[model samples]
Target: MTVFRLPDLGEGLTEAEILEWKVAVGDVVTVDQAVVEVETAKAAVEVPVPIAGVVTELCAQAGSVVSVGEPLIAVGVAENSETARYREEEQAGSGNVLVGYGTSTAHRSRRRARPTAPPPHGRVPRVISPMVRRLAKEHGIDVAALTPSGPGAIVLRKDVEEAIAAAARPPETVDEVRVPLTGVRRTMADRVSRSRREIPDATTWVDADATRLVKLKRNIRNTDPDARVGMLALFARICVAGLRRFPELNAHVDAERHEIVQVKGVHLGFAAQTDRGLVVPVVRDAHRLTLAELATELARLTDEARAGRLSPADLTGGTFTLNNYGVFGVDGSTPIINHPEAAMLGVGRVSEKPWIHKGKVRSRQVTQLSFTFDHRVCDGGVAGGFLRFVADCVEHPEALVTHL
Candidate 1:
């Protein structure tokens, strides 16, 4: 018997939720055949069967979360069959042992099902993490009164807190009912935490007059009824130009290999705020796309991200990231660097501001650009120069057409 274990889907992910199982017991699977779909923090990926054989048992059911090195499925192989030979080959290390290994099918365990009993009046079913349960008990909150927001009616930490807060309010006061954070929300938290702790971030801010860019967008909107030029698309173009001027900023810092992997094409990730959480979807080869094309792709990505229809591939291979915090009426903030990437750009809120131009005071539409870089890979001078280049492009919107 050959056991299939959950594999690491990259980005140091140690566990994944079983989104679906493509194969069932008594079904035959071929080598490299996708047997299950698992969702990690980064994305959802299909895991393939290593050895061809009949599936004997599936340990984890759909929607069940499994840790790394846990046995997921068991494949039964004939004693003298080709699958047995392949298993032997795999054990001998002849075949690649990539990242995750196969599980041992010696014994299989079943997961316990949740109780189906209806709760009493004015009480909600609680589905909570082990840690949250202990915390709730300590806080004197009734766990049974908390509604579960986890997968398949499970309880979460946020659910417990919201329940406690609602319980504290008066009966006459209507509270906004709590909703569980799932799918994208869970994934975003993991990725953001990883990026924050792993990357060394440094930020530099510069103010620029976006008067010309705003006017150009207005002209486009006037000429073409369907054209909608947002600040993000304009900034994306500027990022591509800056990346072209300094190719070093367009590279990934591979710390394990101790090498800088320089990318030829420009793939920019636009950070969009969705109802679930912040998701950054990539626009591949932004340098080759025209302003209209960039606008279209950005719109599409933003819509998909907001709708939670983004695929795994849509979120990968980002050379750089842009966060437009200006829309929320905030001046500037030190944005966190996306891991592996050297830097990230934050566009602050744009508003009318007084400035001295040609020794004359004038009000202009100005915004602050915050460029956050990984200090380990880039110096202050290099980071400043890149920000200056981006600011110059934004200030002179007409110059972008020539580069395009």
Candidate 2:
């Protein structure tokens, strides 16, 4: 019999809740065929079986949380057949964990520890590869200082050396009543804790006359239902322009290294509240996308996020963030900076308000724009300038043509 354990899905994840089983017992699975879907704190991921054989038993039922090294399935093997060959490969060779990746026997097995070394930073000195250990030793770096971006908190060499180079840096649970941090909520707590602890943040906000911008979106609203350019999309465009003006906010501080790290392109992350919880879905290269393109992507990602179908990649790699809290019927917010990124631009509700137009009192669509930034990156002068530029774009929508 060949046993398949819950393989480490990377990123120091400890356990995952099995959502569904793709196959039943007695069903045969080929190499790399997904047998189940498991939801981690990160995302709902489908787990694939490594070797091909008849399913002897399903150990864990749906909705049960299984630890990283616990048995997931049992497969019965036959000798003198194709299944036997696969079983041979499993025993003689490296066992595949994630789809398209394998864990070599040598990689999984541990070598004896050196006579003397630095004490473990965490609960235990994380099980890491010999090469990773050697690299840490050569550099005189603590393995514990190197955060684990690998499976079950094992430190990756890239994570360690990045310490050498520049260095760099949720689900929801519960219901109508009070709930506990089981899934996405727990994930967000850890992240927000890190963001608040490491970042020296500041906030600035201003109200803008968005009458022209509102009209522009309304005019183009029905032009293409597939690609609806709304207020958020326009604000996104303005943010792209703002980032161009103040590149400092587009950067992050390597706190350990005490150096500023500026990102290359703008992977714009927008906050979307879903049934699961608050999640940020990123649009890659927001600077290159047009208004319609940005709108389509926003709608697509928002829909996916709401449905809980967003992949881990869809939720990460944001160099800057654009948060539109106005949809919640609020006027302003002191947005918490999405960590690793230096700043977050928030937009409150755009509603009619009294304003002076041509020296006469009139009603205009005005909105509050708030910017929270890393004080380590720039001073109030730069933060103020970025927010003011956004306000200017809202007041004069025609400026977009020139800004673009």
TM-score, prediction 2: 0.56
Worst 10 residues of 1 by lDDT: 105-114
**Candidate 2 per-residue lDDT over residues 1-404, each given as its tens digit:** 88878876677667776656777777776666667776665556777665666878889865467887788988776555655665576556434445444322222111221222234665444555555567678877788766766434446666667776653322356567778886666766777789999888999989899999988888787676666788889999999988988888888888789899998788999999998888889999999999889999999999999888999899888999899999999999999888889999999999999999889999999999999999999999999999888889899978878868
Candidate 1 lDDT, 17-69, residue by residue in tens: 66557777777766666677665555456676766668799888655668876
Misplaced by over 4 Å in model 1 are 1-181
What TM-score should be assigned to candidate 1?
Answer: 0.55
Single out the weakest 10-residue window by summed lDDT for candidate 2: 105-114
